[model samples]
Target: MNTPKVAEHIVNWLKEYATNAKVNGFVVGISGGIDSAVTSTLCAKTGLPTLCVELPIHQAKNQVSRANEHIKQLKNRFDNVSEAEVNLTSTFENFKTVVPSFESTAKLDLALANTRARLRMTTLYYFAGLHGLLVAGTGNKVEDFGVGFFTKYGDGGVDLSPIADLVKSEVYELATYLEVPTSIQKAQPTDGLFGDSRTDEDQIGASYDELEWAMQMKDAGKTVEDFSGRDLEVYKIYTRLNRINQHKMVPIPICKIPNNLK
Candidate 1:
Protein backbone atom coordinates (compact mmCIF):
# COMPACT_ATOMS: atom_id res chain seq x y z
CA MET A 1 0.00 0.00 0.00
CA ASN A 2 1.10 3.58 -0.64
CA THR A 3 1.39 4.69 2.97
CA PRO A 4 1.29 8.38 2.13
CA LYS A 5 -1.74 7.98 -0.12
CA VAL A 6 -3.54 5.89 2.48
CA ALA A 7 -2.85 8.49 5.11
CA GLU A 8 -4.07 11.25 2.88
CA HIS A 9 -7.22 9.32 2.03
CA ILE A 10 -8.04 8.69 5.67
CA VAL A 11 -7.40 12.30 6.63
CA ASN A 12 -9.61 13.52 3.83
CA TRP A 13 -12.27 10.97 4.74
CA LEU A 14 -12.27 12.13 8.33
CA LYS A 15 -12.49 15.79 7.32
CA GLU A 16 -15.33 15.14 4.91
CA TYR A 17 -17.25 13.04 7.45
CA ALA A 18 -16.94 15.63 10.19
CA THR A 19 -17.86 18.42 7.79
CA ASN A 20 -20.91 16.56 6.52
CA ALA A 21 -21.97 15.51 9.98
CA LYS A 22 -21.79 19.12 11.22
CA VAL A 23 -19.40 18.15 13.98
CA ASN A 24 -16.53 20.36 15.03
CA GLY A 25 -13.80 17.72 14.95
CA PHE A 26 -12.93 14.47 16.67
CA VAL A 27 -12.17 13.14 20.16
CA VAL A 28 -10.02 9.97 20.52
CA GLY A 29 -9.14 7.88 23.54
CA ILE A 30 -5.35 7.58 23.63
CA SER A 31 -4.15 4.20 24.91
CA GLY A 32 -0.48 4.82 24.06
CA GLY A 33 -0.76 2.05 21.50
CA ILE A 34 0.07 2.45 17.81
CA ASP A 35 -3.60 2.29 16.80
CA SER A 36 -4.71 5.31 18.87
CA ALA A 37 -1.55 7.25 18.11
CA VAL A 38 -2.05 6.75 14.40
CA THR A 39 -5.76 7.50 14.68
CA SER A 40 -5.37 10.74 16.66
CA THR A 41 -2.70 11.88 14.24
CA LEU A 42 -5.00 11.24 11.30
CA CYS A 43 -7.69 13.29 13.00
CA ALA A 44 -5.19 16.04 13.74
CA LYS A 45 -4.19 16.16 10.09
CA THR A 46 -7.73 17.20 9.26
CA GLY A 47 -6.87 20.68 10.62
CA LEU A 48 -9.81 20.53 13.02
CA PRO A 49 -10.03 20.31 16.78
CA THR A 50 -8.78 16.92 17.98
CA LEU A 51 -9.01 16.13 21.67
CA CYS A 52 -6.82 13.31 22.96
CA VAL A 53 -8.27 12.01 26.19
CA GLU A 54 -6.35 9.96 28.78
CA LEU A 55 -8.67 7.93 30.95
CA PRO A 56 -6.67 5.68 33.23
CA ILE A 57 -8.26 3.12 35.52
CA HIS A 58 -5.40 1.51 37.41
CA GLN A 59 -3.42 1.52 34.18
CA ALA A 60 0.14 0.29 33.87
CA LYS A 61 2.78 3.00 34.15
CA ASN A 62 4.45 2.26 30.84
CA GLN A 63 1.14 2.37 29.01
CA VAL A 64 0.26 5.68 30.68
CA SER A 65 3.68 7.09 29.88
CA ARG A 66 3.43 6.08 26.24
CA ALA A 67 -0.02 7.66 26.00
CA ASN A 68 1.31 10.88 27.51
CA GLU A 69 4.26 10.84 25.15
CA HIS A 70 2.07 10.41 22.08
CA ILE A 71 -0.35 13.15 23.20
CA LYS A 72 2.53 15.52 23.82
CA GLN A 73 3.94 14.81 20.38
CA LEU A 74 0.58 15.41 18.69
CA LYS A 75 0.02 18.67 20.59
CA ASN A 76 3.46 19.87 19.58
CA ARG A 77 2.87 19.05 15.93
CA PHE A 78 -0.79 20.02 15.47
CA ASP A 79 -2.18 23.42 16.32
CA ASN A 80 -5.72 22.06 16.68
CA VAL A 81 -4.73 19.20 18.97
CA SER A 82 -5.51 19.30 22.70
CA GLU A 83 -5.30 16.94 25.66
CA ALA A 84 -7.35 15.86 28.68
CA GLU A 85 -6.42 13.55 31.53
CA VAL A 86 -9.08 11.94 33.70
CA ASN A 87 -7.74 9.54 36.29
CA LEU A 88 -10.57 7.08 36.77
CA THR A 89 -9.02 4.97 39.52
CA SER A 90 -11.31 6.27 42.21
CA THR A 91 -14.34 6.12 39.97
CA PHE A 92 -13.58 2.54 39.07
CA GLU A 93 -13.12 1.59 42.70
CA ASN A 94 -16.42 3.22 43.58
CA PHE A 95 -18.13 1.35 40.78
CA LYS A 96 -16.72 -1.94 42.00
CA THR A 97 -17.93 -1.19 45.52
CA VAL A 98 -21.51 -0.59 44.43
CA VAL A 99 -21.63 -3.78 42.34
CA PRO A 100 -21.95 -7.10 44.12
CA SER A 101 -18.60 -8.81 44.55
CA PHE A 102 -17.82 -12.34 43.50
CA GLU A 103 -14.87 -14.58 44.22
CA SER A 104 -11.83 -13.72 42.15
CA THR A 105 -12.37 -15.67 38.93
CA ALA A 106 -11.18 -15.17 35.38
CA LYS A 107 -14.69 -14.18 34.32
CA LEU A 108 -14.93 -11.50 37.03
CA ASP A 109 -11.52 -10.18 36.14
CA LEU A 110 -12.48 -10.02 32.47
CA ALA A 111 -15.68 -8.16 33.31
CA LEU A 112 -13.77 -5.57 35.34
CA ALA A 113 -11.31 -5.08 32.50
CA ASN A 114 -14.21 -4.49 30.11
CA THR A 115 -15.61 -2.02 32.63
CA ARG A 116 -12.41 -0.04 32.36
CA ALA A 117 -12.79 0.17 28.60
CA ARG A 118 -16.45 1.22 28.91
CA LEU A 119 -15.46 3.94 31.34
CA ARG A 120 -12.95 5.29 28.86
CA MET A 121 -15.51 5.08 26.07
CA THR A 122 -17.96 7.07 28.17
CA THR A 123 -15.31 9.64 28.94
CA LEU A 124 -14.44 10.03 25.25
CA TYR A 125 -18.09 10.50 24.30
CA TYR A 126 -18.49 13.02 27.10
CA PHE A 127 -15.74 15.15 25.59
CA ALA A 128 -17.13 14.67 22.10
CA GLY A 129 -20.56 15.86 23.23
CA LEU A 130 -19.15 18.85 25.06
CA HIS A 131 -17.04 19.91 22.09
CA GLY A 132 -19.36 18.78 19.29
CA LEU A 133 -16.68 16.39 18.08
CA LEU A 134 -17.10 12.90 16.77
CA VAL A 135 -15.73 9.97 18.77
CA ALA A 136 -12.94 8.60 16.55
CA GLY A 137 -12.41 4.85 16.72
CA THR A 138 -8.91 3.31 16.67
CA GLY A 139 -9.66 -0.33 15.90
CA ASN A 140 -7.91 -1.93 12.92
CA LYS A 141 -9.15 -4.59 10.49
CA VAL A 142 -7.67 -7.52 12.36
CA GLU A 143 -9.35 -6.65 15.63
CA ASP A 144 -12.54 -5.22 14.22
CA PHE A 145 -13.28 -7.77 11.53
CA GLY A 146 -10.91 -10.76 11.67
CA VAL A 147 -10.96 -11.68 15.35
CA GLY A 148 -13.32 -9.18 16.94
CA PHE A 149 -10.79 -8.57 19.69
CA PHE A 150 -12.57 -5.49 21.01
CA THR A 151 -15.19 -4.93 23.70
CA LYS A 152 -18.73 -4.84 22.32
CA TYR A 153 -19.73 -1.36 23.47
CA GLY A 154 -16.63 -0.40 25.38
CA ASP A 155 -13.66 0.48 23.23
CA GLY A 156 -15.81 -0.67 20.36
CA GLY A 157 -18.19 2.26 20.75
CA VAL A 158 -17.40 5.16 18.41
CA ASP A 159 -18.95 7.67 16.06
CA LEU A 160 -16.52 6.88 13.26
CA SER A 161 -13.71 4.42 12.57
CA PRO A 162 -10.77 5.84 10.62
CA ILE A 163 -8.69 2.68 10.49
CA ALA A 164 -11.22 -0.15 10.60
CA ASP A 165 -10.36 -1.29 7.09
CA LEU A 166 -6.61 -1.33 7.57
CA VAL A 167 -4.99 -4.42 9.00
CA LYS A 168 -2.50 -4.28 11.88
CA SER A 169 0.52 -4.23 9.61
CA GLU A 170 -1.05 -1.57 7.47
CA VAL A 171 -1.76 0.49 10.58
CA TYR A 172 1.89 0.24 11.58
CA GLU A 173 2.78 1.60 8.16
CA LEU A 174 0.54 4.57 8.76
CA ALA A 175 2.02 5.05 12.20
CA THR A 176 5.46 5.34 10.65
CA TYR A 177 4.27 7.84 8.07
CA LEU A 178 2.48 9.86 10.75
CA GLU A 179 5.67 10.02 12.86
CA VAL A 180 3.93 8.68 15.95
CA PRO A 181 6.10 8.51 19.05
CA THR A 182 8.61 5.70 18.64
CA SER A 183 7.81 4.52 22.16
CA ILE A 184 4.25 3.86 21.12
CA GLN A 185 5.12 2.50 17.69
CA LYS A 186 7.38 -0.13 19.20
CA ALA A 187 5.24 -0.97 22.23
CA GLN A 188 3.28 -4.20 22.41
CA PRO A 189 -0.38 -3.66 21.56
CA THR A 190 -2.68 -3.85 24.57
CA ASP A 191 -6.14 -2.63 25.48
CA GLY A 192 -4.77 -1.49 28.87
CA LEU A 193 -8.11 -2.53 30.31
CA PHE A 194 -6.82 -5.26 32.61
CA GLY A 195 -4.45 -2.90 34.48
CA ASP A 196 -1.67 -5.43 33.93
CA SER A 197 1.00 -5.56 31.19
CA ARG A 198 -0.46 -8.48 29.26
CA THR A 199 -0.11 -7.96 25.51
CA ASP A 200 -2.90 -8.48 22.99
CA GLU A 201 -1.00 -11.44 21.62
CA ASP A 202 -1.12 -13.09 25.01
CA GLN A 203 -4.86 -12.71 25.14
CA ILE A 204 -5.44 -13.80 21.55
CA GLY A 205 -2.89 -16.62 21.53
CA ALA A 206 -1.62 -15.35 18.17
CA SER A 207 0.36 -12.40 16.95
CA TYR A 208 -1.25 -9.75 14.76
CA ASP A 209 0.93 -10.90 11.89
CA GLU A 210 -0.30 -14.44 12.31
CA LEU A 211 -3.86 -13.27 12.58
CA GLU A 212 -3.49 -11.15 9.48
CA TRP A 213 -2.27 -14.09 7.50
CA ALA A 214 -5.09 -16.21 8.83
CA MET A 215 -7.54 -13.47 7.94
CA GLN A 216 -6.28 -13.41 4.39
CA MET A 217 -6.45 -17.17 4.15
CA LYS A 218 -9.97 -17.16 5.45
CA ASP A 219 -10.93 -14.46 3.01
CA ALA A 220 -9.64 -16.79 0.29
CA GLY A 221 -11.82 -19.58 1.71
CA LYS A 222 -9.06 -21.82 3.08
CA THR A 223 -9.94 -24.07 5.99
CA VAL A 224 -8.06 -25.97 8.70
CA GLU A 225 -7.63 -28.97 6.40
CA ASP A 226 -5.17 -26.97 4.32
CA PHE A 227 -2.46 -26.34 6.96
CA SER A 228 -0.17 -28.14 9.39
CA GLY A 229 2.08 -27.61 12.43
CA ARG A 230 2.25 -23.98 13.62
CA ASP A 231 0.34 -22.88 10.55
CA LEU A 232 -2.50 -25.19 11.51
CA GLU A 233 -2.44 -24.00 15.07
CA VAL A 234 -2.66 -20.34 14.06
CA TYR A 235 -5.37 -21.09 11.54
CA LYS A 236 -7.45 -22.90 14.14
CA ILE A 237 -6.95 -20.12 16.67
CA TYR A 238 -7.94 -17.48 14.13
CA THR A 239 -10.99 -19.35 12.83
CA ARG A 240 -12.31 -20.11 16.32
CA LEU A 241 -12.06 -16.46 17.34
CA ASN A 242 -13.59 -15.29 14.08
CA ARG A 243 -16.49 -17.67 14.57
CA ILE A 244 -17.15 -16.79 18.21
CA ASN A 245 -16.74 -13.05 17.78
CA GLN A 246 -18.96 -12.87 14.68
CA HIS A 247 -21.42 -10.96 16.84
CA LYS A 248 -19.04 -8.03 17.02
CA MET A 249 -18.36 -8.07 13.30
CA VAL A 250 -22.04 -7.99 12.33
CA PRO A 251 -24.81 -5.52 13.06
CA ILE A 252 -27.14 -6.20 15.94
CA PRO A 253 -30.02 -8.49 14.97
CA ILE A 254 -33.59 -7.24 15.08
CA CYS A 255 -36.58 -9.55 15.01
CA LYS A 256 -38.94 -8.38 12.29
CA ILE A 257 -42.70 -8.87 12.70
CA PRO A 258 -44.61 -10.53 9.89
CA ASN A 259 -46.99 -8.30 7.92
CA ASN A 260 -49.79 -10.83 8.25
CA LEU A 261 -49.41 -10.92 12.03
CA LYS A 262 -49.38 -7.15 12.19
Candidate 2:
Protein backbone atom coordinates (compact mmCIF):
# COMPACT_ATOMS: atom_id res chain seq x y z
CA MET A 1 0.00 0.00 0.00
CA ASN A 2 2.72 2.43 -1.04
CA THR A 3 4.67 1.53 2.08
CA PRO A 4 7.40 4.07 1.52
CA LYS A 5 4.93 6.89 1.05
CA VAL A 6 2.99 5.82 4.14
CA ALA A 7 6.19 5.69 6.16
CA GLU A 8 7.19 9.15 4.99
CA HIS A 9 3.79 10.50 5.93
CA ILE A 10 3.95 9.05 9.44
CA VAL A 11 7.45 10.37 9.95
CA ASN A 12 6.46 13.84 8.89
CA TRP A 13 3.34 13.65 11.01
CA LEU A 14 5.35 12.74 14.08
CA LYS A 15 7.77 15.56 13.47
CA GLU A 16 5.01 18.08 12.99
CA TYR A 17 3.09 16.85 16.00
CA ALA A 18 6.12 17.04 18.25
CA THR A 19 7.04 20.50 17.02
CA ASN A 20 3.51 21.77 17.43
CA ALA A 21 3.31 20.34 20.92
CA LYS A 22 6.70 21.77 21.79
CA VAL A 23 7.88 18.48 23.18
CA ASN A 24 11.62 17.82 23.28
CA GLY A 25 11.47 14.25 21.93
CA PHE A 26 9.77 10.87 22.06
CA VAL A 27 10.08 7.92 24.47
CA VAL A 28 9.01 4.49 23.22
CA GLY A 29 8.85 1.25 25.16
CA ILE A 30 10.41 -1.33 22.88
CA SER A 31 8.82 -4.78 23.25
CA GLY A 32 10.76 -6.41 20.45
CA GLY A 33 7.51 -6.97 18.54
CA ILE A 34 6.89 -5.76 15.01
CA ASP A 35 4.61 -2.98 16.25
CA SER A 36 7.18 -1.53 18.64
CA ALA A 37 9.96 -1.94 16.11
CA VAL A 38 8.01 -0.06 13.45
CA THR A 39 6.81 2.59 15.87
CA SER A 40 10.26 3.23 17.29
CA THR A 41 11.78 3.39 13.84
CA LEU A 42 9.14 5.88 12.75
CA CYS A 43 9.89 8.02 15.80
CA ALA A 44 13.61 7.80 15.10
CA LYS A 45 13.03 8.85 11.52
CA THR A 46 11.69 12.16 12.76
CA GLY A 47 15.27 13.15 13.62
CA LEU A 48 14.18 14.01 17.16
CA PRO A 49 15.97 12.48 20.13
CA THR A 50 14.21 9.14 20.57
CA LEU A 51 14.82 7.01 23.65
CA CYS A 52 13.88 3.35 23.22
CA VAL A 53 13.51 1.77 26.65
CA GLU A 54 13.50 -1.99 27.14
CA LEU A 55 11.62 -2.65 30.37
CA PRO A 56 11.54 -6.41 30.80
CA ILE A 57 9.57 -7.88 33.69
CA HIS A 58 10.76 -11.46 33.52
CA GLN A 59 10.67 -11.16 29.73
CA ALA A 60 11.76 -14.03 27.53
CA LYS A 61 15.47 -14.05 26.75
CA ASN A 62 14.88 -14.14 23.02
CA GLN A 63 12.54 -11.16 23.31
CA VAL A 64 15.08 -9.14 25.25
CA SER A 65 17.81 -10.03 22.75
CA ARG A 66 15.62 -8.96 19.88
CA ALA A 67 14.90 -5.66 21.62
CA ASN A 68 18.61 -5.01 22.09
CA GLU A 69 19.30 -5.88 18.48
CA HIS A 70 16.58 -3.50 17.32
CA ILE A 71 17.99 -0.68 19.44
CA LYS A 72 21.47 -1.31 18.07
CA GLN A 73 20.15 -1.23 14.53
CA LEU A 74 18.26 1.99 15.16
CA LYS A 75 21.26 3.65 16.74
CA ASN A 76 23.42 2.74 13.80
CA ARG A 77 20.86 3.95 11.30
CA PHE A 78 19.81 7.14 13.06
CA ASP A 79 21.92 9.57 15.01
CA ASN A 80 19.02 10.62 17.24
CA VAL A 81 18.17 7.15 18.52
CA SER A 82 19.31 5.95 21.96
CA GLU A 83 18.54 2.95 24.21
CA ALA A 84 17.94 2.01 27.85
CA GLU A 85 17.39 -1.32 29.59
CA VAL A 86 15.44 -1.47 32.84
CA ASN A 87 14.92 -4.98 34.16
CA LEU A 88 11.75 -4.94 36.29
CA THR A 89 11.59 -8.61 37.24
CA SER A 90 12.53 -8.03 40.85
CA THR A 91 10.19 -5.08 41.15
CA PHE A 92 7.26 -7.06 39.80
CA GLU A 93 7.98 -9.93 42.13
CA ASN A 94 8.14 -7.61 45.12
CA PHE A 95 4.85 -6.01 44.17
CA LYS A 96 3.23 -9.41 43.75
CA THR A 97 4.31 -10.44 47.22
CA VAL A 98 2.48 -7.51 48.73
CA VAL A 99 -0.84 -8.38 47.10
CA PRO A 100 -3.32 -10.46 49.10
CA SER A 101 -3.80 -13.95 47.73
CA PHE A 102 -7.01 -14.51 45.80
CA GLU A 103 -9.27 -17.55 45.91
CA SER A 104 -9.38 -17.49 42.15
CA THR A 105 -5.92 -18.08 40.77
CA ALA A 106 -7.21 -17.29 37.30
CA LYS A 107 -8.25 -13.76 38.33
CA LEU A 108 -5.00 -13.23 40.18
CA ASP A 109 -2.98 -14.31 37.19
CA LEU A 110 -4.81 -11.90 34.94
CA ALA A 111 -4.35 -9.04 37.40
CA LEU A 112 -0.64 -9.73 37.76
CA ALA A 113 -0.21 -9.85 34.01
CA ASN A 114 -1.93 -6.49 33.71
CA THR A 115 0.32 -5.10 36.42
CA ARG A 116 3.31 -5.67 34.18
CA ALA A 117 1.84 -3.44 31.50
CA ARG A 118 1.05 -0.75 34.05
CA LEU A 119 4.59 -0.92 35.38
CA ARG A 120 6.00 -0.44 31.95
CA MET A 121 3.69 2.48 31.39
CA THR A 122 4.84 4.10 34.62
CA THR A 123 8.46 3.62 33.63
CA LEU A 124 7.88 5.14 30.21
CA TYR A 125 6.27 8.24 31.70
CA TYR A 126 9.06 8.58 34.24
CA PHE A 127 11.60 8.84 31.45
CA ALA A 128 9.30 10.95 29.38
CA GLY A 129 8.92 13.49 32.15
CA LEU A 130 12.63 13.44 32.95
CA HIS A 131 13.56 14.12 29.33
CA GLY A 132 10.59 16.30 28.45
CA LEU A 133 9.53 13.79 25.79
CA LEU A 134 6.20 12.28 24.84
CA VAL A 135 5.52 8.55 25.19
CA ALA A 136 4.97 7.06 21.75
CA GLY A 137 2.52 4.16 21.85
CA THR A 138 3.07 1.01 19.80
CA GLY A 139 -0.41 -0.44 19.39
CA ASN A 140 -1.87 -0.98 15.89
CA LYS A 141 -5.52 -0.76 14.84
CA VAL A 142 -6.33 -4.47 15.15
CA GLU A 143 -5.05 -4.78 18.67
CA ASP A 144 -6.08 -1.34 19.87
CA PHE A 145 -9.56 -1.17 18.35
CA GLY A 146 -10.59 -4.47 16.70
CA VAL A 147 -10.50 -6.69 19.78
CA GLY A 148 -9.44 -4.04 22.33
CA PHE A 149 -6.56 -6.26 23.46
CA PHE A 150 -4.53 -3.61 25.29
CA THR A 151 -4.74 -2.81 28.98
CA LYS A 152 -6.42 0.51 29.77
CA TYR A 153 -4.12 3.22 31.18
CA GLY A 154 -1.29 0.81 30.62
CA ASP A 155 -0.16 0.02 27.09
CA GLY A 156 -3.08 2.11 25.93
CA GLY A 157 -1.81 5.23 27.75
CA VAL A 158 0.48 7.38 25.68
CA ASP A 159 1.04 10.90 24.43
CA LEU A 160 0.50 9.80 20.87
CA SER A 161 -0.38 6.67 18.85
CA PRO A 162 1.54 6.88 15.62
CA ILE A 163 0.40 3.56 14.16
CA ALA A 164 -3.00 3.25 15.82
CA ASP A 165 -4.77 3.51 12.44
CA LEU A 166 -2.82 0.73 10.72
CA VAL A 167 -4.16 -2.81 10.92
CA LYS A 168 -1.91 -5.72 11.88
CA SER A 169 -1.29 -6.73 8.24
CA GLU A 170 -0.55 -3.15 7.32
CA VAL A 171 1.87 -2.97 10.26
CA TYR A 172 3.72 -5.97 8.86
CA GLU A 173 3.90 -4.33 5.45
CA LEU A 174 5.37 -1.19 6.99
CA ALA A 175 7.81 -3.24 9.05
CA THR A 176 9.10 -4.88 5.89
CA TYR A 177 9.41 -1.53 4.16
CA LEU A 178 11.23 -0.04 7.16
CA GLU A 179 13.78 -2.88 6.89
CA VAL A 180 13.08 -4.01 10.46
CA PRO A 181 15.19 -6.93 11.67
CA THR A 182 14.15 -10.15 9.95
CA SER A 183 14.05 -12.03 13.25
CA ILE A 184 11.66 -9.46 14.73
CA GLN A 185 9.52 -9.38 11.58
CA LYS A 186 9.22 -13.18 11.67
CA ALA A 187 8.54 -13.47 15.41
CA GLN A 188 5.01 -14.14 16.61
CA PRO A 189 3.19 -11.19 18.21
CA THR A 190 2.92 -11.30 22.01
CA ASP A 191 1.97 -8.81 24.73
CA GLY A 192 5.02 -9.87 26.82
CA LEU A 193 2.90 -9.34 29.96
CA PHE A 194 2.06 -13.01 30.65
CA GLY A 195 5.58 -13.83 31.85
CA ASP A 196 5.08 -17.02 29.82
CA SER A 197 5.85 -17.46 26.12
CA ARG A 198 2.28 -17.68 24.88
CA THR A 199 1.61 -15.91 21.59
CA ASP A 200 -1.10 -13.21 21.38
CA GLU A 201 -3.31 -15.34 19.12
CA ASP A 202 -3.15 -18.18 21.63
CA GLN A 203 -4.66 -15.94 24.27
CA ILE A 204 -6.96 -13.94 21.96
CA GLY A 205 -8.83 -17.04 20.65
CA ALA A 206 -8.35 -15.91 17.05
CA SER A 207 -5.53 -15.08 14.71
CA TYR A 208 -4.95 -11.42 13.84
CA ASP A 209 -5.69 -12.15 10.18
CA GLU A 210 -9.12 -13.53 11.09
CA LEU A 211 -9.83 -10.71 13.50
CA GLU A 212 -8.82 -8.11 10.91
CA TRP A 213 -11.22 -9.58 8.41
CA ALA A 214 -14.01 -9.68 10.98
CA MET A 215 -13.37 -6.05 11.92
CA GLN A 216 -13.57 -5.02 8.26
CA MET A 217 -16.77 -6.99 7.72
CA LYS A 218 -18.36 -5.53 10.85
CA ASP A 219 -17.39 -2.02 9.83
CA ALA A 220 -18.99 -2.64 6.44
CA GLY A 221 -22.25 -3.69 8.18
CA LYS A 222 -21.97 -7.31 7.04
CA THR A 223 -23.49 -10.21 8.96
CA VAL A 224 -21.68 -13.33 10.19
CA GLU A 225 -23.29 -15.54 7.56
CA ASP A 226 -22.32 -13.07 4.88
CA PHE A 227 -18.61 -13.66 5.43
CA SER A 228 -18.29 -16.66 7.73
CA GLY A 229 -17.63 -19.00 4.76
CA ARG A 230 -17.24 -22.25 6.73
CA ASP A 231 -16.50 -21.36 10.35
CA LEU A 232 -19.35 -19.43 11.90
CA GLU A 233 -17.69 -19.84 15.29
CA VAL A 234 -14.88 -17.49 14.28
CA TYR A 235 -17.32 -14.67 13.66
CA LYS A 236 -19.02 -15.33 16.98
CA ILE A 237 -15.73 -15.28 18.81
CA TYR A 238 -14.66 -12.02 17.15
CA THR A 239 -17.98 -10.33 17.89
CA ARG A 240 -17.94 -11.42 21.51
CA LEU A 241 -14.45 -10.08 22.01
CA ASN A 242 -15.27 -6.83 20.33
CA ARG A 243 -18.43 -6.38 22.37
CA ILE A 244 -16.82 -7.13 25.72
CA ASN A 245 -13.67 -5.11 25.17
CA GLN A 246 -15.35 -2.20 23.41
CA HIS A 247 -14.96 -0.10 26.54
CA LYS A 248 -11.21 -0.04 26.13
CA MET A 249 -11.43 1.56 22.69
CA VAL A 250 -13.55 4.57 23.62
CA PRO A 251 -13.67 7.43 26.11
CA ILE A 252 -15.17 6.85 29.51
CA PRO A 253 -18.97 7.10 29.45
CA ILE A 254 -20.64 9.65 31.67
CA CYS A 255 -24.26 10.17 32.61
CA LYS A 256 -25.51 13.43 31.18
CA ILE A 257 -28.54 15.46 32.28
CA PRO A 258 -31.04 16.81 29.79
CA ASN A 259 -31.10 20.54 29.03
CA ASN A 260 -34.76 20.70 30.00
CA LEU A 261 -33.99 19.34 33.49
CA LYS A 262 -31.22 21.87 33.94
lDDT of 1 by residue, 50-134 (tens): 9999998888989989999999888889999999999999999999999999999999999999888888888988998899999
- Look at candidate 2 and tell me the lDDT of residue 148: 87
Error of 2 at 125 (Å): 0.2
- Model 1, C-alpha of 4: deviation from truth (Å): 0.6
lDDT (tens digit, per residue) of candidate 2 on 1-262: 8899999999999999999999988999999899999999999999999999999998999999999999999999999998888888999999977888667687788898889999999999999999999999999998888888999989999999999999999999999999999999999999988878899989988888988888887888877767545346667777888899989987899999999999
Model 1 ranges off by over 4 Å: none
Model 2 superposed RMSD (Cα): 1.6
Ten consecutive residues with minimal summed lDDT in candidate 1? 189-198
Q: Judged by lDDT, which candidate is best?
A: 1
Query: TM-scores of all models?
Result: 0.99, 0.95
**lDDT per model vs. reference:** 0.93, 0.91
Q: Which whole-number lDDT from 0 to 100 does residue 57 have in model 1?
A: 86
